[model samples]
Every structure is written in structure tokens, then in C-alpha cells.
Target: MQPLTAYCMRGHRQVEGWLQRGSLSILWSLLEAQRLHALAGDVAEIGVFHGKLFIALALSLTNEERAVAVDLFEMKRAPDFEQEFRSNLEQFSVPMDRVDIRRCASEMIALSAAPEIFGSNVRLFSVDGSHEYAAVIHDLNLARACISQVGIIALDDLFSAWSPGVSEAAIDFLRHPDNRDIVPLAISAAHGPLITGASKLFMVHASQVDFYASELMRMNRQSFKTRASFCGVKTLVFDFTNGVRKRIEFR
Candidate 1:
């Protein structure tokens, strides 16, 4: 088990200001700093919200490792939001030369469609593109297909989604028995930034997730908030993918 380096910033870093606070950046950095040991092959961000997590992962890797940032960048709700995200990344302290920010996910996936993306070995993957069921499932297939051994993949908004399909996709992913191989890691405490005013539940997958599931649920469980500062409220999903693949086969 590697250590996710503890980052302590004196002043506020506005990586979030760049793209709706893409918390996947924090999770990816933690995974890179923590789990991944052998040299990683490639680092990718599926959502690529203005390059926040992309820049963070890019800055995290050594020059030799390739970092790919993919997003629509077309201003989802408005025409100028993506630029603001870009501006925020520019203002932050990130290494640009080591990073390659792609225009879209389809474009990046297109590169390896012929020979398999994993033939090159994917090291780190962060998915924040769409919380919808179909989108998440598509991203999951892509990530699983591309990721190499000892690779770490993270999905944004796994806990709380605007739509039920997100959680449904997640539940289906986890309950699968073939998924017994992958495990969960307890990191729901990190979900604080995403949920504005609620104590939520989420999942994390790792080699030890099965062992840690009880402890993690305890940490995020609504019933056990005895801390004086704790407030019982809403919860979200994280990485309940362990023991899931078989469930898919059964149905």
C-alpha cells in the first residue's frame, strides 16, 4: 500500500474554480500518490472539466508518463464556462509541457480503437464525464479495457447523482460476483467537497475494500454521527464495485 501524499496548501487553491470543483483531481492525486507503485503507463481524465483534474494528474506525474485530458470544453451550460476553467488551470501551479489536453473523449478513445488502448497499458483513469447510467457504463467499459495492471480508476459523483440511473449503474457494477476481484478503499471522507450541506455515503474500490467496507460505512453512516460537529444529512455513492461482475452475468 503506497501513501497518497498529504497536500497542505497555505492559501486556497482554486482548482475547483476552474471546473465545478472537479474533486476527482483530489482522488486521482491520492491514488497516484498512494496505491500505484510500478511505473504507470498513461494517465487520463474522462470528464476533463476545464482540465482541473487533468492538470493535477499531469503535474503529479514525472515527465516520462503521458497525461491526457479529454472533455467537450464546449461550454455545457453556457458558452464561456469552459474558458473560465482553462483560465483557472493556467493560474494554478501545474506543469503544462507534460500534459496533453484533448478536445473530447471520443477523440482520445478513437486513438486505440483499432489495437486496444490497454495494449499500451493505462496507469490512472478518472471519470467525471457524465453521471448518467449509459455514460458511466460506457466509461467503465473504456476504463476497464484500457487500464493496466496495478492501475487505479476513479469515478466522480458515484455517491450522489442528479439521476437515479447513476446509482443504478453503480449498484449493478458492484453486486456483480465477477467483480469480487477488485476491492474498495475507504475514502468517502474525501467526499466532503462535493456534498454542500449533507453527510453522505459513497463507495471506494481497492484490494482491501471488502475488509474496509464495514469501517468505511461506519465513517459515512448516518446513524453513527456522534461527533459534536457532525450533522446527520444526505449521502452519496462512491465505489461499490466489489463483488459485482458475477451479478451482471447472472442477470
Candidate 2:
């Protein structure tokens, strides 16, 4: 086979780089900037790749705050996902004064891990471990249980087919009445269907023609480099008792 051209190589590198960084730092930064109460709750990360992001958060949190990290501490194809997350945290000079790493697999990200502690003050939760459907749901449910009241959980890979089940499970679960509190804070359009030609577009059970149109409209207006994402989700679980269709489509 002939040698690949420089342009093709560069494109390949960029794609690989994105997969490594996971979520944009700006999104996390915005969430962190919010005013938080002292000792409000714990800050946890299920997929602590290399602990860079985890370190970043730990460093930002106050001394009284708890930065609990859970990861395999083993690096895989995910370059940023360090095998030894603790080492990375140390390398980054992250003060462990408040950081507590569970050093466990995502299996810990379930109610079974700490059932009695359900609905605890887990102020912020970030999940980026498995890309499979079942795993994503487990993580989502776990995140739901841990998040504090009015807390926000950022679902990474909203745009990557590497985990189509993520968006699907999220939309489906959040559509339910029980999960009406889960809201979308800010969706990134960096990897949605409009830009990534995503084969699937997951809409919640309550999704309507107007909502669909609005999402599509947003996709169309976005710049070329920016991908259309679900941004923020507000739980508006409508009562089915009201004579309304489950789903609606508009021309």
C-alpha cells in the first residue's frame, strides 16, 4: 500500500487527541466556577483517566472539600487514562490533603457499592469509563444516586458513537417521572449528528416536534468546527394522564 499523505496523518492525530481529552475543560470549568457551600459534599470521578482532570478538580477544591476519585489506575488505549491515576495526581502536584481515590473499577459506581449512602451530598459526578450501553446505564444510575440536590452530572461522549447507549439511556431515564430532577446544564454541539453524521439521535420519551426542531435548528446554526450537543437538559416530566401523545413529529 502507498504511504499516507501528511493531511491524512494530521486528521488522524486530531481525532485521537479528542478521544483522549474526553469532555472539554471549559464545560467542567463553568461547572466548577459555581458558588459552592463549604463542606457541602464530595466531588467524585468514576473514570479518572491519568488523574489530570481529577487533579485539576482536587487542586481547585477547598481543603475541607473531599475529592474522591475511583479508577483502575491502569492506562489503556486512552492515553489520558493513566493506569496509575494516583501517580499522575502526584506528578501534577495535586495536594492529596483532600483527595481520596478509591482506585477501583467502575463497578464501584453503582448503588451496590454503597447502597446506604444513596442520595448523599455528591456535589459533582463525572463518568467516562466504559462506552458500552449496560455500563453507561449503570454509571448513569450510580451518578443519579450520588448527586446532591440541584447537583449537576456531566455525561461525556454525548457525541461519540463509541457509546451510543450513553445518550439513549440518558434520554430514556431522564424522560421518566422519577428522574425529573435531572437537568441538562450545557450541551456541547461539538459531536452531535449534524457535525459527526451520527447514525443515532436519542430523544427522550417526552421529546416533541418543537424540541426536535429546536435541536436541529441549533445544529444548523453552529459553526463548522463546533459540534451540536444536547447542551442542558431540564426534566419536564409531563403527566400521561393528560390526553397527550407519547411522541410528536413536525414537518
Least accurate 10 contiguous residues by lDDT in model 2: 1-10
Task: Name the runs in model 1 displaced over 4 angstroms.
Answer: 1-12, 17-29, 32-38, 80-82, 105-119, 176-180, 187-251
**Model 2: lDDT of residue 142:** 80
Instruction: Count backbone clashes in candidate 1.
Output: 26
Worst 10-residue lDDT window for candidate 1 reads 242-251
Q: Give the TM-score of candidate 2.
A: 0.61
Tens-digit lDDT track of model 2 for 1-251: 11111112132233222222112323232233332223255666666665544554565455466777766756555444444565655655566777776656676555766434323566567666665677777777787777665344656666465667777766666665776655454443343333332221222223232443343333222211222334344321211122212111111
TM values, all candidates: 0.61, 0.61
Candidate 1 per-residue C-alpha lDDT over 153-219 given as tens digits, one digit per residue, 9 for 90 to 100: 6655544645556556655665556554443332332223443311122233355334334433433
**lDDT of each candidate versus the true structure:** 0.47, 0.48
The TM-score, computed over Cα atoms with residue i paired to residue i, of candidate 1 is 0.61
Tell me, by TM-score, which candidate is best. Answer: 1
